[model samples]
Structures are given as structure tokens and as C-alpha cells.
Target: MAKPPPQPPQEPPQGGFGAPQDPRSGSTDGPSGYGYPPKQPSGQPGYGYPQPQGHAPQTPPPPGAAPGYGYPGPPQPGYGYPGRQPYGQQPYGQQPYGMYPQGTYPGGIPPQGGRSNQRMMIVISAAVAVVLVIAGGVWFANSNDGGKDDVAGTSGGSRGSEDGGGTDPTEGGGERPADADAKAVLQVPYPSSVPVDSMLVPGQWATAKTYAKPSVYSITGYHADTGKKAWKLPLDGQVCASSRHVTADGRTAVVFQERKMSSDSSSEPCNQIAVIDLDAGRKLWQKKLPGDRVYSTGLSLTISGNTVASAWIGGSAGYSITGKELWKSASYRGCRPRGYGGGKALVAVTDCGSGIDNEYKVQKIDPATGRAKWSFAAPKGLKNVNVISTDPVVVAVGAGSVSTTDIMSLDDKGKLRARLSLERPEHGQPKYDPNCRIDTESCVTVAVDKDNLYLPSEEHQGKSQYGDTNEIIAFDLGTGKPKWKSDAGEKRTILPLRMDGDTLIAYRQPTLDSGGQVVGIETGSGKQTVYLRLPNETSESERRLAPGYGTGALYVNGRLFMSRDSIRKNSTYDKELALAFGS
Candidate 1:
């Protein structure tokens, strides 16, 4: 992996109340990378522990633990722990209100649901300028060995993203239907059970009850396509969480939970595992994992076929759909589990090297047996290799330095298909036009659909790297050939949300660069077809938000439920979840 090229913060001010900003530029001075936290004691809360609300501010690891597993080295600094904001400090995907003048944001930010930040680094970098500049025409080839750069990670663990604002079915253009008269079903409001996380299951909406440790946590099944509540399954534990994706058959669910902590004890994470039958709305099997290894957060849970795997501080573990313990790999000798994906294997970091010349290997493990499936070693230059996505594609990035990045894309069979070099002259950050949110960048910013992949093509043009020249590049998924190139719109912007059949659902940033609109584009020709101007987006609290603020959307069943922060009653911030229904 090459060093991660600089990237603009996903949004100005990251989150929390703030004034509107003109943060379209890029910079190299985002959050510094590759600083991991120290290993926590089994009986004490370690770093990244969520402060128990109303309790003390810090917690240690757990108690009476067996010999720990692999190298659970300190967590690198690019991202953060869950259930809490970074607060006052900037993380990888976030930046202050403003920075440089040129921007192209692609990597770093994960798509909305991709929430993990651990992986070995295979970083690489090469540049000779006040800022690194690279030509987009030089197609890269994957190498088994490369030199490593400093500790910056291209798509490390920064968590922040763009908000999408689409309206109801009434605000349309040409012959398209309207976007909205409102952002919600005015007659019904979100239950007090405001969902902290949600997923689309076959014929139903599965939502995890909020994590309120020392109290209660649960998983609820809702009627499909409607707000009607179906079955609520509660658990007895200190904390609770569910996988973002359920089993392939959609009949089983895997959740991680923890035994509660005493008021004066360590605030350990969810260490218990539970597998449920969605159809029966009952627990099929449950067990407490061995040792003191702790799954970082909800992002660590991944499901491939009937097997589910989790990456942890002490090591990584895999489980059968029936909650049977398959294998648990111990963390040791600098080798540890970073994360698992690719639909068939768990990707782990087998090295904890430091500086510009450390050696690294991204190991693929069989989830069922914890056996080494295969490995991709640093060619000799790259280190701090973080492999983010692994299902539809294998997306791994190694850094060359803080300013230059080498991006490697591998197909489903672990074959390197394409490599790209990203950089800017002034060390400006990269600004993606289809401004991908922080979480979904890996497989989304450069989306792969069926036999083809779509990526943004931006050039230095004259001297800057803020993407003055932008186009959509469609490539053969396996061969990485230029099948077609389409104009992304001159001056205007296209922030693709997801692919809908032959069309791409995208949020078209205002042509004047002030407002936002949602439109649909046919992927074959890259032509705009359906359009909807969100009129109700500018609420009392959102009047001054930036382009990607105060918005979110997901296509469920047939309704595109666009979400926004509704101003909370009697509050200083507009922070309640208000959803708009659109066609």
C-alpha cells in the first residue's frame, strides 16, 4: 500500500452545531495517521472505551483473562471508538470548518455502514514538490513488494460523511414526480426508540435497540415497508449490537453483547455473542467468547455466507450461524486481526511495523477454522496496509507518505486488477465530485456493479488537484479497461448515493453551489433522467448547512427514505432524526 494522499475533511466542522462553510478545498493537514492505543488489562477498561453515561469518564479492560492472543498493539489515530464523538480533535475523515483551496475526497471516509478501522498497512509514497503531484494517465500495476512511507493511511478509520436531502413524491422535474411536501409522514413520528442503527432484511426492517449499558439493549423486528412494529427481542447484558448485514439467507442474525460493569469497575465492551432466528424472533444460541479479546464496535461484525467473523483487540473470532465457536486466533508478535470481509475470508494485519521501511503482510484467514487462506505481502515499500472492503471487491490502500497515495483494487479472486496514484501539487486534499460519504468510499466512491466498475476521473489539469476537470470512468470489473467516459457535469457536481438498476441515485449539488438536489442518472449513457429539488431541506436549523450536511437516504422496498436532523424541541441544535419519504 502507498501512503494515503491528503484528502479534504468529509465535511466542515465534522458534526455538531456550526455555521455554514465554504469547505470545497483540499489539504494535507487532516488527522495524523497510524497511532494505535496500548493493550488494555482484561479487568480494566482500555482506550476507546465509551464512557458510561452518568458514570466516570474513562474505563479499563476486563478481569481474570487467559493469555491474550496476537499483537493487539495500540490503536492507530486515524479513526475513533464508537458511541462517542472525537470532540475538539480532528480525525481522518473530519477537518475543521475550512482548509485549502483544491480538493478531491475519495478514500478515507467509509460508506455509511462501513465502520471498522483496523488493518495492517502496506504504505508507499513518491513525490518531489511543495506538494506531491501525479499524472492520472499512468496506470499502475500491483506489486508484491514496495517501500513504506510515514504513518498516514489513505482510508484508515476516519468516520464522518455527507448527508443526503431528498424530498417527498411531489417535487419533481420535467415528467418526474415531486421530491417532497415534507420530510416525514407527518401523521406518525419516529418512536422514542429512535434507531441508532438500521438494516433492511427480507420482508422486514431489523433495528437494534440503542446501547444503554447498565440498563438494557435489544433487537427489534419491524413490519416491512412500514413503521409498524413487529417483534422486540431483548437481551440481558451490559451492552448490545448487531451486524450491519444479516446472513445471506436473511434468516439468522448475529449480535455481540457484554456483561455489565460494576459502577467502580472497568467499562468492558460487548463480549457475549448471540445468534437469533429472525423468523421465530428467538435466540437460537448464545455464548461468551474466550479470553479478553474485545470487538472494537458495531463495525467489527461481518457476515460471509452462513459464517460471521469479528475482529478484536486480543485477536479475531469466527462463528457458525448457530452460534457455535468456529475458531479464535490469538493476537501476538505484532500480528493481529484488523477486520474481515470479501464474503469468504477474514483479512488481518500480521505486522505492526513503524516508520517508512517496515515490512507488512495482509493475511487472509478462513473464518471457519482460523487457518491462513493466503497472503498479500508488502512489495518492500508499503506498510500500514489497511484492507477496507472485501465482498464485491478487495480494496486495499498503502501510503507512500502523508501527501502521496497508491490505491490498489483487487477482484473477488484476490487478483490485483488496477492500481491508481492520487496526489495534489500543494498537498491539497482530494475532493470527490460524487462526494462520497466517509463510510462508503471503498466500494461506493468507485462503485463495482456486476461486470463493471465506475470511478471518478480527475486530473491536475493545469496545476491544482481540486478536480477542476471531472469525468466518470467506467471500467471492465476484472480487466480494468476504459469502457466509456462520461462528463460528470461541467461546474455542477454529482454525489452518487447508490446504484439503482441501470440508474444511479445521486445528490446533485446545486449548480450555483448553494443548494442541493436529488436526481437519477442512467449509468449506460450517464444522462440525467429523474430529478427532484428538495424544497423542504432548509429547515429552521438547517438554513446554513454545507452541501453534504443535514441529509441521508436509503432505498428500502420502493421508498427512498431520506433522513435529516429535525430540530429537537427546546434544544439549541437541530439533532433529531427526521426522515422524508420520496419516490
Candidate 2:
């Protein structure tokens, strides 16, 4: 409900496709017109299952209807996937001006309030334990410019006992020091000559032994504990789409182009899919989809069990991890599978029809056979569906004109349990926006566990006029009510990465003086624990990097990994390919 304290101007992001775009400032620069190609009458829902017999006739939503506004009524024919029917179309398209934009928060933290004395004591102990865990290896140096713009080795450098490179001179590639733990910090420099049109560098994965990410046309693994290059797997062309899911053994899938992109030519097709083992650093198998079809440059690739599924504008197909063809589903009945969400279960989101006739369906899919286990049809006129989680089954939906207005939680069957309103938070409450992308599973700022959904409150002005702050709120999945909320403390903001057991692992954005931190919030109690305190020395660098667009942040095995989603050619500023921090 308040604006952040005023701070120094942040440099605009270096130009490139999928470059980080922080939404806290309300900046609207992005791919034009919803970031998807226009669909024709015969066109696909850029991205289904079956059930029920003919029942009641459907009533189309009124013109200018928006979710949580004038729109009302349960999904027609109830919730199950519709069998082929002659249900007519309804004209719809009204934007909710209250919905927040997609992306990360780039605002100052707020002053502490609203917590009991007991909770304050718990946070204090956790902070002390974090410092003790890192021991003598880390320090928070003083900053003259409020910690903004100071490089690690410059005159205002905030690091202690460090060189300009952000690494010890004697600590070349070798065994990680026993002292290196979650508090350790390292950075990888950006590759030179990356083309602006290359479009994407889209995956981030971690193993106990290595931290791996795509750098332009190659995938490289770095020693997890020490910042040493372990292995690099070069590709024939730049990576286009990648699965955020990884197999237990550290293997993942990526789709790349057949030939290197040329600056003189239009973008190349992303037609080749490959499975790479991150720990061992080798491609297990690579194959091209059958037929040319001029596949959409942005294909949705995901892994569920041993099968890797891909969907695009033309159609959808499945493949084994060993590269065996499983099954393929072509468009049928004016509906096309657009993308997939993979994990504990495989799920697919399909778009059917065009314009007011357009409808989106979320289906629980069979990983191996390409059959629909069950399907849930979203209300007509809500054009986009982003699967936030597969197991408990949470989805964020919005109308054609906005990013997201509500979140729907469903049961194991295709029935909807509750719909959480994002467009209409309680009065005085900060507006909620997950900033979900067009893909099925690309809502990066939101996370869900079995019983509750977690999202960050939009940053607002703090009690002080000097800065802004926010909190993470959890909602009960069954009733769609607020369960608890946790603050990120003064001058800091936090985003949920994922679940580490019952604890919610979150990253506290760096401030002008303090480096970013890794925090664990107990789900039931809403208690906060500071697990890792990064070096104040590199706070400026850490502040410059926040997860948004194709870029991301991950915490696993006590290490924090961040990567720029893409790189641009002829940039005025230097940007790192990726940065890793650990104890």
C-alpha cells in the first residue's frame, strides 16, 4: 500500500531477447501483443482430455466481461473436459486494470513491523547462525553510495580480503576448500559477441557436483563448490526451449536450432531436441522432429518421468529419454495442445477455437501413451493458462488482454476446488500478479506445495519515505484464503524459489549495503531463517541480477545460482553469463 523509498536510478537492461525485466517499477517494455503470433480461424491455441455427455446449453460470457468483475457463473457443463460439442462462442475481452505485471521486484525493503517479539527473536538467532556458519570467510564492507554501483574490486568495493576478480588469487581450479559452504560466492563472465537476435539462453540446472547453464550456443558445467569450469557441451546452434525439470540423475532436455543463427538472416528454426547429462557433461541423444512445419521458434519442452514432451504451434510429440518416439498428437476438433507442465505428474494446456470462441483446457496427461488421464476446461474468454504446479494442480488464468487475474486450484480429478482472486485483493492489500508467461509452466515468481500456494506481495512504500518493502503470502489451497505472510525485513525484498522439504527457500534481494541472502521460511509457523548471507562486497552485482523473463534463480544443496536468460551483442555494459554463491 506504500511506495518504496527513493533510490539511485537503475541502468536500463542491456538490450536482448528475454533480458531481465523487473516489474516492480511498472515498466511495460516487452515482446509486443502478448508475445505470441496471431491465431487464424484454423489456427491452434498456440499450445486436451475427455469426458461428459451432452447436458445443458452453454451461455457465452457477455461482451466486456472480466474475471472477478462482471463475469460470473460456474464453468458450463461443470468442470470435466468437454466431449466434442456444438457449444457456440461468446464475445469477450475486457482488461482488469488492477492486476500486477509479470516479473521481479526491484525496490527497497521496508521497515520491520507486524511481527511478535518471539518471531523477532527467532529471526535474530537465525541471522547469527548464518554468520557463524560462514565463519571468517565473509564480511560486509561499508559503502559510500548506499551500496549501489560498487564493483567488487573498485574504490567502493564492499568485499573483505578479496581481489578484483571476486575470487582469491591462490584459489585457482582445485578441490573446494573445506570452509567453502553456503556463504561462498563466485561469478562467471559473459561470453563475447552474443548476437541480439539469438533470442534465448533458457535453462538452469544444479547437481551436488556441478552448476550447469547454457552460455549462448554451448552448455557448460562449473564445479559447484569452487568456481572452476568443469565441462562444456557445444551445440550446433543456440538453445531455444529447455525443460526446467531435471531427472534425478542430473539429465535434462533442451531444444536447439539446426544451424547457427546468422545476423543477416531471419531467426533459425528450433527443431532439434537433445538430452544432456549435466553431471557427466555429454549429450545422450539428439533428434529432429519429423517434417519441416516451420516450428514455432519457442517450443515448450518438458520432462515427466522418462519421457520428454514437446509442443508448438503445429502439433505435439513425445520422446523417451533414450530418444525413442513415444507418441504424437495432431490438432483435432479445433483444439491444439500448446505446451506442457511436467513433474510429479504430466499436464497439458490446450487452446481451442479463436476469439470469443477461444477456450483453454488443462489436462492431466499420460506421460508415455499421450492419452488424457483427465481434463478441466477453463471458463471461456480467459485466454491464458499457466500451470504453476502439477501434483496439487494450481493454475493462473487471465483474460486475453491481461497477464493474470485469478489462480485456480484443482483436485486430483478434473474438479475445481477453489478460485483465488488476484485482481481483487482485500482493500489496502497490495495487488497480486504472478507475471506468468504464455507458456504452460512459466510463472517464475509463484510457487505451490501440497496444501498452500505462495506468492510475494507487490512492493509498496514502507513506513519510511526512504524505501519500499514486501512480504510473501501463503494461501490455503482448499478454501483460497490467506494462511500467513512473512516480511523480508528492512530495505530487502524476497521471492520464492521452490520447496526444500517443508521449508520454502527464498532469496532476499541485495540492498545498497547488504549482499543478497538465502532464507528458509517455515510453512506452518511463518518463521524465517537466514541460511546464507552473501558478501556485501558484491552486493551491487547481486542487486543488478533478479529473476525474470527467461532468466532465473535456484537454491539447492546450499548453493544459490542465477543466470541471465539471454545475451545481446554490442552492449554498453558487461553482464555475467551466470553467478553462483555457496557456503
Candidate 3:
């Protein structure tokens, strides 16, 4: 075929796509223009343009576009006629396909140099949606009402009030005002008669005193703030014993001689618990037990609310203070039971035997109804066991080839929630030489205050020899985590632990001396205050001293009770000390 004649180059439409066409041009401006098509350049085709000879075939238009839309021209092809009107304007009343109606594009189509306007619109819509979601979340969080209900459900809820509520002080079911006739009264009773061996003023109570001649024993009493005898309970008979117990409200006094009996094998059997009403000189109540069981002098007598409990041994049958019989297992042969923290609950351990075969059984008892709560068989190799506390939970220490500790947590219904083993250093070579013939297997003393437990350990040589070298370690009762450890030295042994406000007063015995000493220590700060030596001097025939923070006084009945003889020896020479507190 003959080559087509060369044509002149054509100009692109003046207006871009989407722009209005000018009436003066008499035709649409863009690629879709109507009427005569523009001419092509030399070596290119005109109007309905065709490809040059040997040129590659061009791509077709999109499905909806005209046949030549998007088609690439030949290398030397000239610009073609404006294909159609720019996309913006259309025949009047004949809307452009796919274009939004007029006034829809308030700012018109966005600049098209980079991304398509449609893509930019989608991006902006997504960003606005994300911002709205964030704002909604923030508002919901700030307006939360859950915390208010939480506070209202707490113990302190009643103290809260709504705004504008009148200050009648009776809103929200608050307590009513006291009656006109209501009077503030002291629960404790005042002392009356004074004992002959009285030492200090009536405000002080006498814990214990020994007799030198005739019948050998001690007679102690509780005194009142007015220097009067509240109650006088004698620690007499051949098997005399006393325990330092505090009332639920923290009244300090000796719970002595729940029952008394003669040590002589020929004496009549007695089985009564003599509960001394310390503040009133009257007996609270004496509950008869099975036999003449007696408690050691230093054991803790626990009192919670109005119930008092202790571990006693004497009768053929072993029983708790609530009159419940204890299980007679082989594991509880030589061991004596002791109680901790008050409640209707108690923990006790009984010896199994000696050596590898040795074992102990720990029992939980309900004090209120005299019922058995739970029982656990300790490891077979344990040589000794001690019950620490039962309020927060029940914890016991077992000693054997390896010193292992076990803790048990109980719910209010006496159900075991968790059984945990406390961590301790593995048994290794003895810290002290093997030749050091000391009592290593002695029973460990365990005490608990609030949520912390204090365990007994040997004192090191770093501190004074007279101090308790073996020390007390504190552990979190709830989690069994260690809190702190205290080393007073080797000589000091924790006896009766008392608290005056936040101060901890431990009745300790110095190793250098045989008797006990009252050491005042701060609970929170772990600081020591007074270290008053107990009246245990050998040379002094008779002496009496008052210790502790408050009124340091010692009284018997309404009079001061003096110590007439040292606790050690009560030979024939000290006759006057015999009549001190009355045999």
C-alpha cells in the first residue's frame, strides 16, 4: 500500500479532564471531543488515526472508554484531535457518566498531579473514622462508674455520702446518737483487799511469786487501775503452773492454774480448770476436764474474744480447753500441745518417736464446739514439731535430719486451701564444731503477730553472749515469704511476747544468767528500749522490781507484792519468803 501523506502536529485540548469547555472553541476540549478530530503530525495518521507501517500494535482502551483511549501512538505520531470534551463539562441537562452532580464537589476535584482524587478521599475518610473511635474510647474511660460501686461495697462504704445530703449525721444508715441515759463504762473491775506481800501500787498486777517454806508455790493476782484486787488466782498445789495470756482487747495477765493437783502419787486426783477473773478477784468459770492435766509455766494461754485455750497434760485422756478429746495417735506421745491466736481453732503436735522412725501428728481443733477440725501426718523423720498460729492460717515447724517447715492455710469453714513448704538452706555441715556438745534438737519456739511469723534460730557469736544468739525470723503468714530476722544474741530466749502499743516486750532469758529478762523492742522500727533483769539474783534473798513502759508497779490484791525469794533455791533458810503471798 502507498504510504499515507505526512500531516502537521495537533495541539492538546486547552482544558484538562473535568474542566468546562469554552463556547468559543465550538467543540469539547478533551480526548472525548465531538465533531472533526484534530490532524496528526508528519509520518502519523490524521483524524481517526491509524498506525504507521512497521509500528507495533497499541493497547486497547479500558472496557468503558472509546476504542483508542489509553492507546500509545507511534514514535513519530503527532498529537490527535481532542478526543472528547474534558471530563468535567457535558451537554446541558445530560450529566456526565459517573460524575457527582454539580455542587457535590464543593472544592471541586482535588489536584491530580500525584494520587487519584478518589484514593485521597478514601484515605481521609479512614483517618477520620480512626480518630472518632479513639475519641469514643477516651470518653468511655473518663466516664466510668465502676470504681464508685467498688468503693461503695468496701467496709468504709457507709462513711461516704452523696453531695447536698443534709448533715443530719444519720444519712446512709449511719449509727444513731447515744441515748441520753447511756454512760461510758469500763469493762475491767477494780481491786479491793491487799495481800500482805504487796510490793507496788494497786494499779499493777502480780504475775507470780514463790513461797520458801511449808507449801512451796506462787500466788498471783490481777490488780485494777484504782489499786484494788480484781481477782486472786493461786498457783499452788504440787503441780503449779502459769501461762501469760492477754484478753481479746489486749489486757495482760497470767492465766494460772486452770486446774491444781498434788505432785505426790498418793494425793487425790483433781480435774478442774480454775479461770481467775483477774480484774474482779472472782472466778470467771471453771470447766471440769478429764484429769489433773497441768500446763508448763511458760506456755502461751491463748484468749480470743471470751474463749481461753491451752495445752494440758495429766489425765489419762488428752483433751482441749473446750472439752473435746484429742486423737491418741502414736505421733503425739511425748509432745505437749500449745495454742496460738484466738478463735474457735487450735493447732497441736504430738511426738511420734525418736531417730529415723520419729514422727509427729499435727491436729486442728474447734475450740467453741470441741470438734476435730483437721489432722495431718507429719513426715516420718521429724523429731520435733511446734504449732505457730491458727488465725491467719495454721503453720507448724518440724525438725529432724533436715529442718523442714510446713504451712497450711484454712478457710473460715476449716477447709484447707493451700499447703506450702517454706524454703530453707539445705542441711550442711554443722556451723559449730561437732565437739560443741550443745542441745541442737531442742523444741523450736514459733510465734505469730498479725501477718508475720517469728521462728527460733541459734544465735551467732557476733552479738553479746548474754543476748539471744539464736534469733527470731519473721515470715509473711499469707504468702510464706520471709520478712525480717532478729538476733538478740545467744543468751536471750523469747519467753512471753507482749506488746505495749507498737512496742514489743519479750520476756527473754540471758544465757549468762538463768532467770528471765524483760526486753522492750519496737515492732515497726526494730529498736530496743529497756532490758530490765528479772528478779533472779542468787545473792539477793528477796527482791521485787517493776518493768515495762506504763506504770511500772507490782501489786498483790490492793497492795504491792514483793518477791521474798529468788526463783532458784527455796531451802530452809528463807522462811519469811514462804508467807509472802500466803500459802
Highest-scoring model, TM-score: 2
lDDT of 3 by residue, 260-340 (tens): 322311222223444443334444444444333232311233433344444432211222323333322111234334223
Better of 1 and 3 by TM-score: 1
User: How well does model 1 score by local distance difference test?
Assistant: 0.36
Candidate 2 global CA lDDT score: 0.56
TM-score per prediction, in order, is: 0.54, 0.68, 0.39
lDDT of each: 0.36, 0.56, 0.28
Across 1-583, the per-residue lDDT of candidate 2 in tens digits comes to: 6533322212211121121133343433321122221211111211010100010001111224321111111112213322211101011111221121211111111111111111111111001100001112111111111111211001111112110111110112212223332454558876777664224576688777888888777898888879788999999887777888777677789888787766523346667889998889999999886445423332588887677888865567777777877776444446666578887777788666553344567777766666666767665545467888887888887643335656777778766666665532222121555646556777777778888888776665556444456677777787556767777777676777787557787777766666777787888867777777788776645644565433567776777788766555544343576878876
Candidate 3 ranges beyond 4 A from true positions: 1-218, 222-270, 285-287, 291-304, 308-345, 348-364, 381-384, 401-446, 463-472, 478-481, 485-583
Count of residue pairs whose backbone atoms collide, per candidate: 97, 24, 43
Better model by TM-score, 1 or 2?
Answer: 2
lDDT of 1 by residue, 553-578 (tens): 44333333333312111222323233
What is the full ranking by TM-score, best candidate first? Answer: 2, 1, 3
